[model samples]
Target: MNTTSQPSTADRAFNLSTWLVDRHVEEGRGDVVAIRCGGESHTYRDVLDHVERVATGLRAIGVRSEERVAMVMLDSVEFIATFLGALRIGAIPLLTNPLLPGRDLGVIIADSRARVLVISHERAASLDDIRAGASEIEHVITSDGWADFTASDEDGAAYDTWIDSPGFWLCTSGTTGMPKLAMHTHGDVKATFDTYATQVLGITANDRCFSVGPMFHAYGLGNSLTFPFAAGASTILEPTRPPTPQLVADIVTTEKPTLFFCIPTFLAALTNSDLPDDTFASVRYGVSAAESLPAETFTRFLERFGVTILDGIGSTEMLHIFVSNTPDAHRPGTTGRAVPGYEARVVDPDGNDVADDEPGQLVMRGESSASGYWCRSAQSRATFEGEWTRTGDLYTRSADGFLTYLGRSDDMLRVGGEWVSPAEVEGTLIEHASVLEAAVVGERDSSDIVRPIAFVIAAPGATVDDEELTAWCRDRLAGYKRPKRYEIVTELPKTATGKIQRYKLRR
Candidate 1:
């Protein structure tokens, strides 16, 4: 097992805030564009100046060490400045999706006891009710006047002595109920870049990173923000929600990024779009995570864009992708071998290793794994055991070391004493020409036995009937593995990160 201990004092002395901010200025790259948004570009020097001003503003507002500052703002230079500024002043920043409903946002704010809520003007209008419910939020900072608030010339507190303290919190994409806050230290941030970003992805200073995922999520936090800055590379930030296929294509064409970070849904959409072959001409690598990329999506994207999308699996707890397919050694259907500095295994419920090719829970240990969930002791203990974090994902490992993602362990189905992976069935369903997306859930039949049911979204201008889809699956899947029924839907319910909420489908 690869166990990570608390960072030594010497290790903690190298603060990520300094590495990402001051180092670039010293390297004479201050004038280079660090972030490009809609019509505005911020140089490294410009970003560092904002970070210092925001840090001073945060301290002036009485935000202290280890205080939680909840942020619900769009992706922009201001958002990055606020996050790094909180770190500079020894406060922990909790990044939250701005589009979340008021009730959900209230739950997060109340649970984290955030001293301040940083939000955009559009989102702030609807938060009056949420703020009323969240007693811990003492102040609200809107983006309309965000720049005015950070007009201070002070550099705030020096973080050199407090780098070991908790730095940030990411809310887990709870498959169940309310999301839990996962705590990470500054050391954890550096470790993610060293292991996953530098070692696995091999990002360099020349790479221009573009991401389709929101920075609030773990995947984006690591790939789009942390990794690029750690490598001294520039990133393109979109100020709105994840873009559509045409918009993404346009951004790639205009930005000419070398590294494109995305997820399966976006890949599928791009594959089905009318983008020309040269859309991704400048992109050296495309990466996918947050969910498994279907083999069909993988192949279609390769054929259309002539660039491989490396699929991987990760969680907010792990900070970033621990097991992944690198640019050179990617397999079409499997998330490749474990990255350097991580250990992984497929284990049964008893914690014993399962035979290769047998489906089992994936447990892993790595340096970048979060300390644990904040304020949820019982849940934290259940998830973070000593060195190993039991990822709720189920997978099967091949003899050669590639890992094939099945489905969430809770989403696994036992039908007629046989196991069924919803992802497998869903992947097969999407192979049909008319299906744009598919989700599977286990439902109880009239005989009180579990059965697989499928929800499908048809392709544009394509008509799909229940009988035809069922017959199509009958030829590909085993008799017992086939879905008992198929329902055509206009769209699949998805989280902000683009992951299908199968639990909602079950409900």
Candidate 2:
């Protein structure tokens, strides 16, 4: 097992930066390259140097312990350094999605009451509006600001923050409303690394990690940042916030990563794109989360690139994947099993365990689960119940351990006296040769009955024929499960991490 700095209940210093950034250098792996981004390589020693600079920079700007340091930076060397740096000096780094609009960003800045915002040059374009709304911002650190901050000689003794102190905050996609912060402690990072990254991936220093999912998302946080860093492995940071298939293809071909982390939507795009069969030739495994991977997408990508995708479900509250498909137990359509150190149960609305094969809300109890959402008392209580975190996703567990995704609790459509899983319908729709991506939503018909409606994005050269698509679904899905109407769209609305925003389609 990979060794990491363990946490304790005693009042001891347990900064995540020491474990993820400084430990490698302390252990004589300083020469090992920790990160590769924007055509530059940073060794563990170099990363530590960057961490020190960020720490000193934050100090120079009077950032004290437990302060919120909002980071709106792109996926680059500075992102990891800044995140670790904040942890090093006992500040809470709030990671925001760079693709979020100025208004949402402004709201987050105000909500968190972040005094310092470390942003990229491109994202700083709307600084005026964001700053105007969030007067709490005392300092705005950019590239030029970073250069000066890092170059400065200002330094301080590393703060000995408690192990249970809020280490970082990840913004929930705000699918329901404005984004809320999921507060996780320093120990949470190590917990995810040990359970999912260690037991599942079995990553070693020789492995190279590349993820298309932006670091802001929970899956990507574990996949690209914590997983590799804790194992002393190298991670590839793609600066392109929303990476295109071709762009990702080029990175895989060039970076030659051993482990590839991506979402199902982008994976489908890569499979459907005209990219070469060996586009993912160097990837030994593809880790997928954020949403369920359709069986067709799983099979197609595997047949085309010889890369097996381990599709799993994780949440912001849970910190990372609590259940997943491992190498030995991978099933194309099922979420394999509860990850080591985590326990999962499918329970009904009343929190009673449903019989196997009965769909219910998934609740996970794990050490990596976030403490709770910051400042949302009612929501925090509702989502995080004592030791368990309710995922709000619908799933059916088999008699044994295999679990199948049904869809979100709200996403299950009641149609024609039977429940229809949008995932099941979407899976069938994407199986059609012409369909690239599909989203199924409920719509009331003329008879005031809820029916599934399909919105689809066509494959590269294929045209969406209503009849042909209907025929494809007709053969596969049940009469009630089939989409009542099909609407061809240019693109499905998605979050920055590529989770399909079904609410938008519903709207």
Candidate 3:
């Protein structure tokens, strides 16, 4: 392993694809298992061979350096190979969710101006609609046709000579508005591996990693692909859309992973499922991100299983989790202190630092932070100010350096002239025994005053009345923080990453 400090930018240039993919082959660890998917496994050498062949194929098709290649596929070996392959040949890969609506996908493809698109057969039917608007896409390839394109034995450019250029592009979750592509560099990739994965998470070659989030999302890209590759660790990929608890349990039993990456919604489902207590007995770490883990969900997960989840906060711009909880030093309700090499602060609207325990917007600076949003100059200027990126997230920092999420600044509701954090109200609602999940949003009343309204999913076989839930909240929460009305629903609308779409509820 290269234990030496990272080379100074002025002294040497490096490509992230070469650093992550070629290093294993160079170190003679090619025989080790690198990826496990669909009951099959591939060694590091196999991955490299595939990557080189794909790079050759891309080059043969006139994919020049810095050209954009977008991938709308599942979390499978093909996706991994294509992503690294594009980077290996000096092309920028755009990681996109395949399940996006056709209109949204067209908008993103048009904005990115991607030259080639790799999608699954199931999604190929939407190409006509997407291409009508995204005229720049010159070629489209499906997973079934991947082998035909990469059937050559042509050698790709040597890793040593690969251009040290920008890394893959990731779009924001679009929780606030239309998603923008965030441009990340190779330096940002290495920084995330060094600070978050190696220093904070302590991932090593012996640890088997499994991720529940889709690889298209930044959280999954780092947790499942980049971090494991950096450590020469094995990663398990479940290609099933909306993986069920039984599938996750089966993978845990078969793969025997030491590390598990997940989100709060999945954690809640697993906790409520009939899985045995020992399902996670072999697991060493349970990491949660992408959204705040409700305190009730955290407690329930710990009680149902013997593992404690390390909840953290990260953004697409940051590449990976910069503020996280180490397994040894975790606080249940708070996202732990900042990971090494990163700094965080809570500041008011005026950009002044707020006092401890005061709610304010979270602004962070780190080595892994992205350069800026691609092609969105105005948004980039508003978000990236000098060294810090304005997160638009509302949080409170304790004197002890722990961070507690309140809600998004725009998601906060003014009820009776007092600001109410929807997260707080939803957390309180989830604490009730009959509530499985809850989302709080602001609704205007007859007098044009905003009030808190809750949408809840009841526990299985547990009948919950709106009046009962309102009374339950009244008992535990203050007058202003309690929801004014409750609506029982079978499920809440969620993003692909499992975060509740609060905006949909407001509409």
Candidate 4:
């Protein structure tokens, strides 16, 4: 394939956007429906046209190849177009959760040194605050104002980027409000599509896919955008943040998707809903990730909806799921074997493989692994050791190679499928004038899912109002990271070194 001109099957250079969006149009799939969102349908040709215009628009705004374009927009047609358009010209799109507060978003933008940012309309008010700290951001555009960036001539020169050039960056697994940014190459995108998406999903052009996970997340990126476009299939995108069960039911009933992607919390919500069993009749396979799926939830969903949920584990470092349960090898309790192109191993602290049934760190290596965290040399070295990337989750693999999750190796809690750092939460709690000290720990809720609970000691002569404290944290932390219940205790158990005994708090 030639890199200097339009990408084709005969070209030597590989660009993920061309392969995902433009190639479909060039390969006689122009008329095929590519995406369905907000009561609007776009064909491969239509999406490609938007991609071209966005690419030209970026160039007109002086965005060069390899520069980072930050996106804090929800799932929509504008998002797909801008993301692919940035890729079409070799500009890397940095994905940040749209729901994150301005403080957290500022950390990501400052760390990434992104000069361009695209946000949804609802986030416009935070623009002044977001731009204050991140001086690197020179231009900010709203999601709906994408057409304003376009030029009269949509034709633009595609950058001659190497296959291994950085294509995108994903912000994830942060211990602080700020976290590590995982940078993936263009090859990583296609590698995931060719490996996990094809082998595990068995996706075809005839299928329509929908996901409850947000598109900014790695799980949703693969489910709603990457796999569908690469396989010439159609995708159903939900613009509403945390779409209600009724909304999902409506889409499934009307759009008739063959594949459904979801997380554990949303799956449980749907299972507990009063929606008819046949609501999911059109779905062939359901995919779950971002957190370990409970067996009871899996059983209830399948029995109620008649859709088999394939549970898997993936990370921002690896791009997408590397270990998954397939229809042929079904396991409700355990995360199935390694994907065809990936390898998984449970290793001790010494980096040697551990025996089956012995809980150890889960490490994996695959074609989709990111280059490393941007500007985080220590963490990148700790995570990406030679070939394997440490997942930071403790698990036990059976002799037959089925992996079962135990818990996080660190004090981090997987609440609602998002990592919540106890240290971060505790720090936020103590910031309140009413709290002299605070210790946060994860406890199983009534649903048998993990959530954070905090033990706080009020300052001398200070009042601790649960409602007032809750509102304080609400203003400071992200929604998921906030403690669910605050325990106003007179004292907290501590070690001889004066360290807060988180284990005691857990009990």
Error of 3 at 343 (Å): 0.2
- Scored by lDDT, model 4 comes in at 0.82
Over the stretch 1-507, how does candidate 3's per-residue lDDT look in tens digits?
A: 879897565555677777777899889999999999888989999999888888988887888878899888889999988998888877889988889877778889889989899887778878887788788988888888988888866668643322235777998997756789999876787788889888878999998899999899999998789999999999899888889999999999989999999999889889989999999998888999988888889999988898889899988999889888887788877888889899999999999999999999999999777889899999899999999999888999999899999998899988887889988888888888898888999999999988898998888678878888889888988898888888889988887888777888888
Better of 1 and 4 by TM-score: 1
Error of 2 at 424 (Å): 0.3
Residue-wise C-alpha lDDT for candidate 2, range 6-48, written one tens digit per residue: 6565655677888887788889999999999987899999988
Can you write out model 1's per-residue Cα lDDT over 1-507, one digit (the tens) per residue?
A: 878787677765755677787789898989888888885788889888888888888887888878999998888887898899888878889988788887788888889999798887878766876686678888888888877788766656556644557889999885666789999988888878888788877899888999999899888887678888888888998876757888888889999999999988778888888889889999988999987899999999898998888888889999999999987789988889899899999999999999999999999999888899999899899999899999999999999889999999988999889899999998998899898889999999888988999988888778878888789888999888898888888888787777888888889
- The local lDDT score (0 to 100) that residue 164 gets in candidate 1 is 52
Candidate lDDT scores, in order, read: 0.86, 0.88, 0.87, 0.82
TM-score, each model? 0.96, 0.97, 0.96, 0.81
Off by over 4 Å in 4: 1-12, 152-154, 175-177, 412-507
Poorly placed runs, candidate 1 (over 4 Å): 1-11, 153-157, 161-163
Q: What lDDT is obtained when candidate 1 is compared to the true structure? A: 0.86
